[model samples]
Target: MTRTRTALLCAAALLATTLQTTTATTAAARHEQRCADTSDTRRGEARRVMDIVREAHRDLGLKAALVRVTTDGREVVTGAVGESMAGVPAGTDMHFRIGSVGIAYMGTVLLQLVDEQRVGLDDPVSRWLPDLPHGDEITLRMLGSSTSGLHDYVTDPDFLAQLDAAPFRQWTPRELVAFPLRHPLWYQPGTNWSYSHANFVLLGLALEKITGTPLERLLDERVMDPLDLRETRNSFTPQIPQPVLHAYDDERGTYEESTFWNPSWTTAPGAVLTGDICDLARSARAIGAGELLSRRSYRVQLDPGTVGLPGPTDTCPADVCLPQTEEFHFGVGVIVVNGWVVQNPSFSGFAAVQAYLPSERLAIAVSTTVDQDGASGNTAQRIAERIADALAPEQPLGG
Candidate 1:
């Protein structure tokens, strides 16, 4: 989940309380999580990982690089490199906005509800949002699979212009959905593949209405609670918790700290989330493994019929309507590359990636912020792919 035009999920086993805890309380929670994995003595691997991180941090001019690598739920390495502010060092446990991790969580929630028979993936969302234009033609499956054909509001020129003009604006869900509706459907619903934040935003709304639960509580109960992500949490404001790993960007033609920039337009409101690297890796494991869904639902989560959607059409640009293939494609909210499931979110100077190789039970999570005048991009993703290549060369990860 990223802002392709600009920039671009969960609680513990909450899918969490509002993460307004004092610094000490958050530390205690982190300690408890660390105590659960005490047998991780992979020094050799850890050293290798540290070297990789150091090289990336330096090469990419990252202000801070927070990372966690785990094998079968055991820590292989966890670290933070560089500074959080002028002279303050960043810590591994510092919390950062998880970006599109919420997308995966939202998708997971959809499947969890599906597994419980609360709703069918094929059920039309018109069942809930009766007034949604073309709701009858758009199925929950299409929404979660990003085949809904709705234009990604994040890519709309007007949306980006507004965002650029007012980075601190508190955007409403209806406002975000309005951007896509302003344009005709990208293609017939469910007949093509395109990454649209509108799909997830709409899904979040429909889900809330379907269960009479807010997206925050719904995700915590169904997804985060089961995963036990103590550090993961939802925030109503742009306020990231203490020991925050601050982010910087030059997108506005000025290098500045974007740590508190309102990210409401990124996705649905209640679903915006933040967490530490450890929780990020844990999230990769849970969502990638489909740990909370039934076997049938898990299988569907991995491949929800997007394996070979028709290629980009005239109405759909090739870059926007990405090609879906076996090695690389969209699966629900996650992106599948080789055999790794990934969610990479980059926006407002913060970039992160959580990737899991289900077959190997290996997970890699990385988050980074740019230094003043640093090269700008999703550097975190490039780092994770490199790590995946090093750890599982036989089954390389990436597009």
Candidate 2:
């Protein structure tokens, strides 16, 4: 997931624990089965990518990390470093929370519906959620592109305090959006751009209402199933399915287990998910190529800025808004960085980046964890950029 404003402020406010030895062994076996592949012909490239992962794991003091890359959706390279637990080595099969990547999935589903005439990107949300504030003015396109101007609940001080006080508390969608609804919009709907968890939450509600199907089912049918992302699934409780990568962080003074921390506050009920590195790599390619979307829908999803109406006030800040440029811009559920489509999510001691260079048909996915105090939250993204630079030096992964 893209970093929330509160996550940036509370960078040091995030750790892991001992698990049964049997559990570790089981996880290792399952990981091997899920990640096994023999088609890798780019040994030299794989070694180069592993060097980046190993160096990052040591230099950044990460508890564990994994990277997977594919060229032209055929030649594959995967690597891992450190441990999932105390003695359990990290593997490509181990699952970890993939925060904002879910947003990209939701956006893809919305565009698919648009292509099918099941929904319209410009349709006011009032058509689905009539009681929501300014629902009539906000459109699906605005929500998908984070241009709805809705206040980001994650930036609310009270919400941050509550989250720190009870890291394991499960939050409902209504409760999460209520924090933002209590405050006035940051700017008029469809006017300014700011990354808001509330926007995606509302998008989930609208999608459910429009299709009369659960969000999880809709994602499975529309995205996961078609792409064959077997490792991806929704989480209702704090539980991450087995073969897990234990995450550790020292944000709370002592390094402690944060692998199972409640993520219900992160996104919609069925969209919060954990997956293996392979799935992340696959998703990068599928989303970047927009294989399931029509040409028109793909174009809009890649550049929704065309529909974004600027507000009278300049509320665009460096943290929330990256000024539009030839090399950088926010797309529907995705970020374009130096012409490469990317999505990076960070939360609760886990950070990950999935980047795809459509020109080269290359996909790079990296997931990381921190164990040191005051560590930067963008560790995984930084590592992914290093690997991309090595593989696709012609197209630098720009800020």
Candidate 3:
């Protein structure tokens, strides 16, 4: 029997292929889940979790955010919590830097172009942007997969100083590319995997060269507008609009206010978007159903599973490593968490997770602005697991 929340859930549900439902016992046992009709139940759980985290997590700040879940095109939960800042403003639609998560989404958009023959996956960087070292050797695929051998600009002391001094500065792809383009390859392209924003920065420039449009415009028209994601957008300018979240940095012993210019430097590397729980849930579902790309293009984004790439914690000897995967390899744009979950987090002030049970056509998205220990993937995983367990039909994990 469909519950009252089903209709509300449908409004926010993103498209996805149908999933088969197994016996409730099997569904419940396979994952830490619980069947409930009350969206309030999930919200309460998130609130409770946040209270504990805020008081104890190493990172002491938080932001306004929401979580949404859907099953077979039906919305299950939509709730926002916390204020953007202690006294400034509050809303579910506020935007924040998506950090590395932007890279994954960038890969998805680029692959879609490849699917349409608008571009090619194996195309060299030089084909689009000329006058760069190793332009002939670095391919789009290698850059997306983190095997491009480009050093990250963010690690440089000068880069960090600039970022700190001007957190709200708007930057262009050409300006951002200069950093890594000037450096020697950290390793042979395709020989290793390293997570560097520089790879995606270059990719963003290539995308501009291919489309003849700014990254923001292409992303908005192709991804957000089609989905009717009113609350999600790329803030290219330094002036943040209303209902924005205020970020903070613990500098030495003082907490300093920080603002992320969603466009400028971060662009394709990790900055083209900000969204609420509802839109994000819809986006995840759409991507999973192959709505954003053709089956061929979608396959490229999901290839981390088949290629068996090593992660940061993987037992690989190379400098570039695969992320630890208890389930499958990292897919193209997102990590395949525990065989079912997919998640992305920004270093700024937000983190998000999504998962689907193919058999049941059930999916869930959890997001938070809470930061834990310098954007540690391990911390994000723990938070994701907490929410996943609650959504599971079985008892929450751990006694």
Candidate 4:
């Protein structure tokens, strides 16, 4: 071929290469746009779920946030509605204490120690914590299952009053444990099931005693780090950040601001590091996948504790109850309701619901800054049910 003809052929090759590069770039952009569209669709679905709850519930005066993440590596959706209070700013990214839901995290830590053979779930409390009057009768399993006969300290008016009066006061686990220690047993250990935060408080102290490390450190090293949860941290001081939302007690005739309180005293018992809806949904999904515990330890968690509450609703089977579990009825630390296990409502500035269908690998998390009442639980249930229904349209809500 002549020089001019060869040069023309080279130009053709260069033009084809450029066209291919442009085609690939366009295809990449389209893929990203499609992913964004899917994310927005899921986010919109989540927002609509929250709207249904907001419009339907009148009493809660609720400000709600929700996040649903599917196992297909999709955040799907996250959005907030309502105000932190009647006249306050609209609630968004505000930290709400996850209340007893934190217990499940504590339960995970306890099981981690059990996995190491450092502690036995059924070992008598007397084996490690010998200071209590009835330590011999109580076992670590009972503590996790709420069958230890330990009274909940939150119900003690005097004790609560003391904490309320000095809500920011730094309290040691021993100081917090004293209240339950003063109360007599509700029954012999391993017999009855009750919702007692004190059991986990004792578990936290036991963790400290056995490991010579604070509960917060264990949480960071074991759970938080592995999960890559940045916002979650144990706070036992008044130095908690300022952007936190304040809560209210609507039980009174007039709605009163419950005040901007610190969680210094409730650490381990109720003090969990707080995070956004997305983070919580991720945590819920991780826990449901049994990524945090061994298979045998996971079995221990699912072993139901006892049946203490009113049986399942008429809409569901009789065996299905809240905090659903198998062995002791409590199912480790979570409640089994309608065969669906769940953690209690967090009572701090907000209430939290984290529920997942293990078979489906679908999880929903609802967090709200709202007043407590039937309304609070009802709203959460409705929103959670909607997400679950969307994911599992065949499964009916509880009767």
How do all models score by TM-score? Answer: 0.92, 0.89, 0.72, 0.76
Tell me the lDDT of candidate 1: 0.86
**Full ranking by lDDT:** 1, 2, 4, 3
Per-residue error (Å), model 4, residue 229? 0.9
Whole-model lDDT for model 3 versus the true structure?
Answer: 0.59
Model 3 ranges with Cα > 4 A deviation: 1-65, 87-93, 99-101, 251-253, 260-263, 269-271, 304-306, 310-320, 323-328, 341-343, 353-362, 370-381, 392-399
- Give the Å shift of residue 296 in candidate 3: 2.3
Give me the displacement of residue 323 in model 3, in angstroms.
6.3
| Model 2 segments more than 4 A misplaced | 1-40, 306-318
Give the CA lDDT, 0 to 100, for residue 162 in model 1: 91
**Backbone clashes under 3 angstroms, per model:** 19, 8, 19, 25
Question: Which portions of model 1 miss their true places by more than 4 Å?
Answer: 1-37
TM-score of 3: 0.72
Which predicted model would earn the best TM-score? 1
RMSD of each candidate relative to the true structure? 9.6, 10.2, 12.5, 12.9
Candidate 4 lDDT (Cα, 0 to 1): 0.63
Candidate 4 per-residue C-alpha lDDT over 215-301 given as tens digits, one digit per residue, 9 for 90 to 100: 778878888789876556666653434345566655334455654456545546334566555556667776655679999988777
Which stretches of candidate 4 lie above 4 Å from their native place? 1-50, 56-59, 69-73, 85-92, 164-166, 238-243, 251-254, 265-271, 304-329, 371-382, 393-399
